[model samples]
Target: MSSVPIADHALLSDCRTAALVTLDGSVDWLCLPRFDAPSQFARLLDDEAGHWSIRPVERARASRRYLDDTMVLETSFRLSGAVVTLTDALATGGEDLGHGIGANSPHLLVRRLECSGGEAEVEIVFEPRPEYGLVRPVLSAVDGGIEVLGGADRMVLTSPVPMRVEEGTASVRLRLVPGRVLLFALHHSAAGRPPARVWPQGELAHRLERTAAAWRSWSELHQAYEGPWQDAVRQSGRVLQALTFQPSGAIVAAPTTSLPEGVGGERNWDYRFTWVRDASLTMDALWIAACPDEAAEFFSFLATAAGPPGEDLRLQIMFGVDGERDLTERVLPHLSGWRASSPVRVGNGAWDQHQIDVYGELLTAAHRLADYLTEIDEGTRGFLVACADAAAFHWREPDQGIWEVRGEPRHFLHSKVMCWAALDRAIDLADLLRARGRVPEWTRERDEIHREVLERGWNPEVGAFTQHYGSADLDAAALTMPITGFLPADDPRMLSTIDAVERRLTDGHGLVYRYLAPDGLPGREGAFLTCTFWLAHALALAGRTGRARAVFERALAQLNDVGLLAEEIIPSTGEHLGNFPQAFSHIGLVNAAWAISQAELPAGG
Candidate 1:
């Protein structure tokens, strides 16, 4: 396990929830019911804690990929004379498979094992550690298989193979013949609750087929988009959907926990929660694919999450899937961090920081989905109006900036532009609403914000935009100028800014730094994946399609074998850093691919 890179992991989800599965047949990270919910199995952050793993007993070669369009993952292990495959997914609700669970339902992990050739020995290990390695859960026999418990938290494991229940864990050794199969189901909940009814093997099989069909059915709706990087674009769309929490349509930042930013440094922060920034971008990604249902749901989540008008909106950079706001940061002192990066943090402390750009991001998303916002409840509208009003007044304040830097707030150039964008979008919304008799004051504030940004944010001497008011540092964030329609991609300033970024921010291989200056904390960081994607989009928009495609291909080369990407990539070695499967990176990939597919590529093999 230590030999495998973190990028080897793939993701599986039930739309309402998700988990991280490694290539070697281990579910290293999972939080039971919701993305922000505490983990029942957190071996990714601490190996000795509880995790459910099944792999061939003998040394073998293993490979994996998603099953068609669905979130279902297939990992095959080949021994010298035998082959075995394992399929994993969370039981989803509704449709044919009946694998879906409600928003408030307890968490579950369903894994199926099949022997494809000859007979091979397989091992099943269930080590349940509680409280992030603080408690050693006791494994006891249960009706179907076994149960591991610590205080109120309960982990139930069900398997067809004979098992050993020992100190704090369960194990099984089985000879998997060609016709033999095993089903392992893990249930997490309070101790006194009735054990969840295990899905019969036949029903589980039916659900798996139905789930695949459902994903394909949903994917068929994307035929409207015929851009150049069609396959990659569509894959990005599918990934966004897979990462989304379907009940509310809110997209999480990433599906994994403690996949360190600095590789065991204190930079590790929980990314399972929904970010206002991420969910907003998700709306744009879904909209580009013509998926209105998802767009509408995310818009609604924003409205409810932003709260009523006039009161300070709890504009967390991130939130729980159910919209819970308090994500208290804590460290697991017992477990060695990923690659020995100490202080594995579970919750995000940035939740309480004031990120002024959130309102702008929220408004931009809502405005993009304005055509669908009308279909949402009236409260969402009120929240939108109220949020607009708050942003109108607060747009001038300094914030933590888009990077969510832990350092003191400065007037980050991007954050300020987004503040203006928030107002601009709100004004656009106001006009759209006014034709039908809605809020008119929003239009006035939007105009005022636009004027203020042009005057205060631009730097004349640099021939390019700077990182903040009066700061000379260049930022890759300047790339958003054209993408947001704030300026034409070919506009003098925009072109000069792109050139400036190319000169200062872009390293030789086309990887982009978030900014040239240090971001308040110690140590260096990887080039941001989203920035490179933005560069692709900007180049495409500026009629540099060939350059755009070249850049796009270079960026796509960074994707892991499973086509998953992290928040940042180490420029030299390409080791993934920051959050794994970052939503912004995926969103950027989708948008850039859409742009690049329209650009012609050079003659290829």
Candidate 2:
């Protein structure tokens, strides 16, 4: 944690991979070839890991923003009398590639420098430490540029200003006037792949332009949300798109791994894979922010990726972008985590945990995209039908809850409610999925869950529906009871749950915590940002739009300068914590905004 606040970084993507750039123009976190691949730069986790940075020789006031609707980042650094702008993008194949916009990306990162004010001086630092800072590449000057050789990746750094590099480190300084412009394009090639030709300076600039254009075009055609928090909703839509793996239609929870939930504690976990639960919610959020095409495609990807829905009705809680199973969690004790949060993890052990809530989420996403999925094949149809069956069978059994607690599994009310949601949606989609015969079975189980939740899941002692059956502790997830329509928003029980959560689970601020219960992890964690949005959404649905607006505005204040949010917020400091650019946080933002907008609509307007 270069002590760099997680919120201070901006995201750049070609929809294939992502890079996190700090305010001062440093690519602190980036994974090439693919989002979950070995990092080419891991400075976000440790100081000695590889990083490429360019900044003014003197201190400068920095301001950054995405280029309008696109994911391309533009940062301006102002000093004394000079101002220099840095434009960065991961190049994509331009024009109408539909969902395949980045299918033909050249795996090139383009950073363009331009001077628009008085003369300025800047320095460029090139360091390539591949395989998670384990192998330091030998830098050699080539005809086109510098060739980095070592590890599993060969990187070519092309620049107009020449610099002699002996080891893995290289530095060059350049002076720029009002009319001056410099370009650096770093291209990557892994073993067993034919390496593309080194891009010339002129072509590198051209590809950068095309990448921006492609992103803008993608936004224009897809992002049609014209409601409250329009700017944030649109920006989040781009961020979610940026996190998606183009070829697989899988949405990663975040790009970086091992950013701590509790700084200087052992609470860090990797979030670079496609979580079935998260991806399902992401589909619903994206449906509102963008368009239905992605939602449809994601369902298709899910159907194909999770295997033939298994005779045992089992599916992974999460899967690799390419649908690979067996995600074994391991740690790299070498890299001292951000802020000394040691034991940087690579893979997630939660992937193997029995997260039974996924069935409900998956079927819920399918229900939302039912119209777009009219042409789903029989295999896909059968898979979804099997998912509903799984929910009916597993709703009674308990595994890890939605928070993926490492402790013993209990009867999580949220899991049971989501199971009810699955069966309800399955009944509604019976005709479409050709499973009308199973509706009776699904209905019986659905009603049983509803009855049991109202009886056992609720706590009259606590005046709320507790975290799990018969528990006195409250959970912010209880706020979802109304949002999921399991109970009407204004129902007495749902309102009491909301009031109890606000009264107990908040950080004395508007921000909400997942819970205060021990998660079988050492040390305490920060307030989850997503839970705050859930509070806001619940308030809006419960006819308290005024207070809902206030909560929404308060949560919006936690967004970074560039409108990106992290996974959690430190209650005391109001500082961002956990993984940066978390998809769940943004998804909550988009959905809460939508809920407010809908609630605000005039009666019969």
Candidate 3:
């Protein structure tokens, strides 16, 4: 099992793939070519899976931060008498290369180390494990560095210094003087194609400069969020962009798989695939973060991928980055799980689950982007009608809720409210586009859902809305009532629900649980970070500005040192759980901050 805390790792991305670099100068987890590709380094799951480390020989303390407005990470190591800084980034295609900042490039991971103080000794180790540690690659010494060959994959490591290959591993040690620099670049290819040429030290430095500049340029052009939590919102925006699959405009829930929701539990699931619900909300978050282009692109991708709604009008719950629909789940028992969280999984089984709330999310996303859209195509107009029709027909039936619970279906209040939202947005869209559709039917169904939820989904004895019809359970998802405009935040019923949720669901540390009801899963999980943020957003919308800011700050305080958040947080210990740098958590942060900012504005301003 890996010993490193999940929070100890920082992310590096080229918008095509991602690498997780630990503060101790180890690249522990990485996937080549695509976010869901098999790992090239899997030590984050198992210690012997694979890892590459470059750190000072002597013990040292380290501090790290991202470069100004960029994903480039720099870690400073302070030893007894020496200081060294290691810079890490996944190389980007800059304008200088005649491509845009988000263009895909040859898969390359770059690390530059420079000594600024007294002389220091550093050691380097490289162990390439192909197919998630299923194949141990053969390492051969090449002209500049080393070549790793295994299965159908080939990786070339080019370094300024010679590396010795021993027992399939590469090791090197060097003594560095002040102002001296050392650089290493690892290029990957799936077809065993050799690197075009070894990058010289100067060329590597130039690429680093250009990559940093590209990131800065993109931030300047895209990030327009000016809110009270400016820094947090901008950082969240960057994390969201990093999680995006640039080629397809599909935003992954998280870049990792099988990171257990609860340690030593079977609640683990792969999240690398794009969910209709997550992608739709991600589009809304991007719009609020001043990324209108991304929102539009995402909607376009969804429209094309979804094609025409089927007879049932049920869209695929999720899909691969390339829009493939077969996301079958399987377990890897060969490798020990992270921290003994067993049954490490790949793909996701929930892709086939019937999630009724997706229509609402998709339509709401399209409605949000309508202002930026120049014209509505026939395909999109038909898609909108189909979605609204699906909601109208299915809202009365029971299915999995938004949490994708693995148990029997029930009349989840959130799903019903979102069904109302689906028709609500679709009615608005139909009028805006002047498209032919059952607008009257949609309006009737929308009102019917609203009335049904108010009458049946609420528990009179509990004095609040329940998780499902006839159940008194409180759910964090009900907080979306105001967010989706299904009800006024200050409505007497909504206020009672909010107060009841705070009284029953919160952990007294500002962290909120999704729901305490069992969902065919074993073991307990941490408080969901996104749900906590939703509480803050709901509070702000209800005009409790001061309390909302406090809750928002408490949620912000749970982020890791590098301003990254995970799917959940251990409320008692504040240890991050589940997938790292979760896009949903960041989306919640951005949207919550925007809500507070809007609420704080003067009346009529």
Candidate 4:
């Protein structure tokens, strides 16, 4: 286990939830039904705690990949004289399925295995740890399978394989021949309800086929990119699709839990929750990729989450997939974090922080939605008006900025830019409304924010905009100045700012650090991957394609052997830190790829 790096894990999901399938053939981290709900198998973060894994009986070389533009994963293993394929998916609106299983249905996990050639022995393991592995569920043999009960959650396993049950888990071993297929599914139902297994084996195959077709059709809808890095862009789009929480359109930052930024360094935090900052950017990425409905879905989620008008909308930096707000931070001391990183924590405390950037994300997202809507709905427009009004009233005050550093509040420059974005987007909304005979109040607020940012945030003495007002330090986040259209990428001020950031904060690996300061936390972290892509985009937009491609290549090399990248990469050891396979990191990759691809085009076209 120690030899296998966390980056070796591949993601599988059906939009509502996700699972981490390790290269060694284990489904370690899965939160069934919803992204934030209790894990059905949580062992990825804890070695001995919660897990439901299945693999071959013997150790073997393994590889995994998505089934062509779809969220389904096919992990193949090669052992002596035999090979097997494991296909896994969240059992929801599959083949012939339009959307997903209705939210009301019990959570289901469908594992299908087929032997293509030779013969092989297989093994299956099931371990259910309730409440983050604090409770030991009582397991019993049922009519056709096994039942696990703990607290309010119940799990029923339906399979033809025989297994022994003991302690808090179960395991089974079987021999397989070519053309043999096995289906192992776990159905989660209300307490006392015998697990429901509605789909027969034949129906399961049809569901798989339909699900594959659905994803392929969706991918076809993407207009031809014809860009140089189209592969990277397409991969990023698929990742974004996997990260989206379909029922509400909320996009999670990452799918895994407790893949630490710094091993045993107390930098571990759960990232399986929706973030306005990430979601806003994801929407932008989707729009660029021609995913109109996905972009609109993000705006709808923002509208729903931000609440009606100003009601002091909860300063939620994160929320559950189902829109639950009570993400109280807690630590599980029993099981060590990834690679013995101690004190694994669940639920992000940042949710309680008074980060002001969310308002900007909300407004900017709404602005994009309104601009694209053929006919804007009154409810959504009214919600946007209320949010813009509230933002106009509180644009100047300082609190936690985008990084959510748990330190004293200050005027974070990125936060201010986002505030400016809010007003700017609102003004765009106002212009659209004026043409349509709607309200005209958004113009004043929009101009006010623009003027405020230009006046209060720029520091001429530094020859570049500072990280915040009253500070002279260069911030890597300032790279967004060009991307947001706040300033031309080639403007001397923005160029100087970029040069200053490269001089001060570049980790010497082509990746950018969030800042040079400690950020009120112990131990140093790696260069942020997302910021690196931002720098790449800024470079290309500024007519530095060679430099941009160089930096982009350096960043791309940081992806693990399996083509999966973590949130950050250590400048010294090149070790990946932070959450594994982060959506933010992928989103940045797509943006950088597209920018690099476009930069190669002739200027006239």
Q: Please name the candidate that would achieve the greatest lDDT relative to the true structure.
A: 2
Better model by TM-score, 2 or 4? Answer: 2
Candidate 2 clashes between residue pairs 3 or more apart in a chain or in different chains:
1-338, 1-339
lDDT scores of the candidates, listed in order:
0.75, 0.88, 0.86, 0.74
Q: Best candidate per TM-score, number?
A: 2
Tens-place lDDT digits, model 1, residues 1-605: 13247787888777766778888898877776666666666777766766778999999899988777666789999999898999987766446222122333345677889887699998988876666667787877866677676755766677665588778778988888898777777866664666655456676676666566666666775435666666566667777776777677678888876666676466777888888888788777767754656565676776676566564554667777777778888876776877777677777888888888888777887887777666666666667666666676777678888888888888877776776677677767775433223345556665676676677667888878888888778889989988887788998888999888877897787888889787766667778889999998999989898788878888889888778888888888998887677888888988888766655555461
Among all windows of 10 consecutive residues in model 3, the one with the lowest summed lDDT is 93-102
Off by over 4 Å in 2: 96-98
Backbone collisions counted per model: 12, 2, 0, 4
Candidate 3 ranges beyond 4 A from true positions: 96-100, 192-197, 431-436
lDDT of 3 by residue, 1-605 (tens): 98688899999988888999998999999998789999989998888889999999999999999999888999999999999899999988645222255575567888999897699999999998878889888988878878888877778898888888887789999998998888898888765555534678887888888888888877888888886989989988888888888888888989888778888787888898899898888888878775657655676677788877643588888989878889999998876877888888998988888888999988898898888664657666666677888899889988888998888988899999999999899888887646545788889999999899989988989999989999988999999999999999999999999888888887788799999987788899999989989999999999999999998999999888899998998898998899888998998999999999999999997
Query: Which residue pairs of candidate 3 clash?
Result: none
Q: How many residue pairs in model 2 have overlapping backbones?
A: 2
For candidate 2, write residues 343-452 as lDDT tens digits: 89999988888877888888888998888889888878988998999888888888898999988899999999999999999999999999899989999999999999
TM-score pick, better of 3 and 4: 3
Q: What's the CA error at residue 280 for candidate 1, in Å?
A: 0.7
Whole-structure CA lDDT of model 4: 0.74
The candidate, 1 or 4, that scores higher on lDDT is 1
Give one digit per residue, the lDDT tens place, for model 4 in 153-205: 86778776667899867788889999988777777776465555534577667
- The lDDT of model 1 is 0.75
RMSD of each: 3.4, 1.2, 1.8, 2.9
